[model samples]
Target: MMCNSASGSAAGFLLFTDVDGCLVNKNDYGFAPAVPVLRRLRTEGIPVVLASSKTGCELQHLAEQFELEPAPLICENGGEILWRESDGGNTRTVAGAERSKILRALNGLKPTFQFRSFADLELHGVMAATNLSEAEAIRALDRHSTEPLIWDDAPDRIPVFAEYLQEFGLTLTRGGRFWHVAGNASKGSAMDIVIQHYRSRLTTPVTTIAVGDSPIDQDMLDRADIPIAIPDPEGRFHVQVSSNGHRAGEAGSLGWAETMTRILDDVTGCD
Candidate 1:
């Protein structure tokens, strides 16, 4: 909508992106291909918020690498929000039950379901499952409000498992890597809150560009003024992303760079 309106005249733009399969290539976990586009967006003064199912510790560390110091973060699939205040103080907003409670509920369902959660996998197992380094694995295991697990049960039973989770005030969603169980909070709601945080400080309307590569990011893409969908490495996409404003030319980091370069160029007339 902003692109159709007056892109150059918009007050500001907020870029909310999922980490895996969107910014970072899922295979290699590298984002070098997108670094140039990210740098361009940074130079244009756009704030890029990393929204992912990753733990706060993981997201915080990745944010530093992406140079998103003051940008807000939506972590654990929007179970938490972290940002820096104007006075250089850090603030955190948490949603849903804590990890312990979620794990307790999950433990109760273990007899009925066949799954291995991050808690069960521990550090070494998590590293093997995610192909992350020792330090990154440690960060991934430090979750706050969500439990990511590999579901070994029948695929048809996912709906029933979701129903069972509902009774415990939890829900299930699929991410690029694993299934995530979390509270009622979602990326869309978190985006709204962060947008409000921006609107309250700025005099002009802030345009939002949301990008992702899986069903986990559907809610976020639905809420964005401009939604960009990046396909998986095999060039496949989820069916729920019918409303996306732009579909990338490639998959993973290459696609991320491709679509974002176009959008930024179109919106800001920036080279």
Candidate 2:
């Protein structure tokens, strides 16, 4: 987390948020309850960026439908970034073996580990695993960088699977409810890029507020100027987070809205 200009304290803020369990209902993925706060942010000229383990395609669709279009998006757990502006958009993908190469490496495990990657799953399987609609599952299949795997939690042989993947420069991490495999990319890196973009564009330095609900968002949350941690549906946080930041009483979208409203009151300085 690079230090900003001295005047950053009085400057307005930019937001980098996670979608699944942070901005939306973890169980249903609906974000309607956060609408008023989202609209207020727009009115106050605060940029709301979506950073998530979901693919670029998923975030792109949400950016449009949720009225966050033209906003920068951190996708595939920061495996890729979509920076959109009024003129056009640009993408920066991290250096790593694409999922195809990683998949081949995993396939070398042969009959040892049954590969249950998102690529191999049928619509029903995707729906059952993610609780996403058919259309949403199709959007999820548009992944280009990381492979989201539904591992069966094999202990003894899991080390071997990880070792083989390391040979290909692939790293795996636990995400929402699945295992995400990718190269050396993270949400923090994407946040850095977005923060730099904001610094370059705005005359007044921008403060960043990051909100997340899970361990997957730790990198972004830790790096943000302000970090808000929303609890799980069971009203528990996945990791220790935001001791100084506000906590939402409820979970999911309501929690998201609850926290966002606080931010609006505390930061925006708008009536």
Best by lDDT: 1
Cα-based RMSD of the predictions, in order?
Answer: 3.2, 4.5
For model 1, residues 189-247, the per-residue Cα lDDT tens digits are 89989999999987778889999888889999998989989988788886244454898
Which regions of candidate 2 deviate over 4 angstroms?
1-11, 87-96, 155-160
Q: Which ten residues in a row have the lowest lDDT in candidate 1?
A: 1-10
lDDT digits (tens) for residues 90-178 of candidate 2: 65655445778877876776577865888678677888889888999988887777888888756566677777778888887777788
Total backbone collisions for each predicted model: 0, 0
| TM-scores of the candidates in the order shown | 0.93, 0.88
- Report the Cα lDDT for residue 217, model 2: 85
**Model 1 TM-score, all chains together:** 0.93
- What is residue 166's positional error in candidate 1, in angstroms? 0.6
Please report how far candidate 2 places residue 224 from its true position, in Å. 0.9
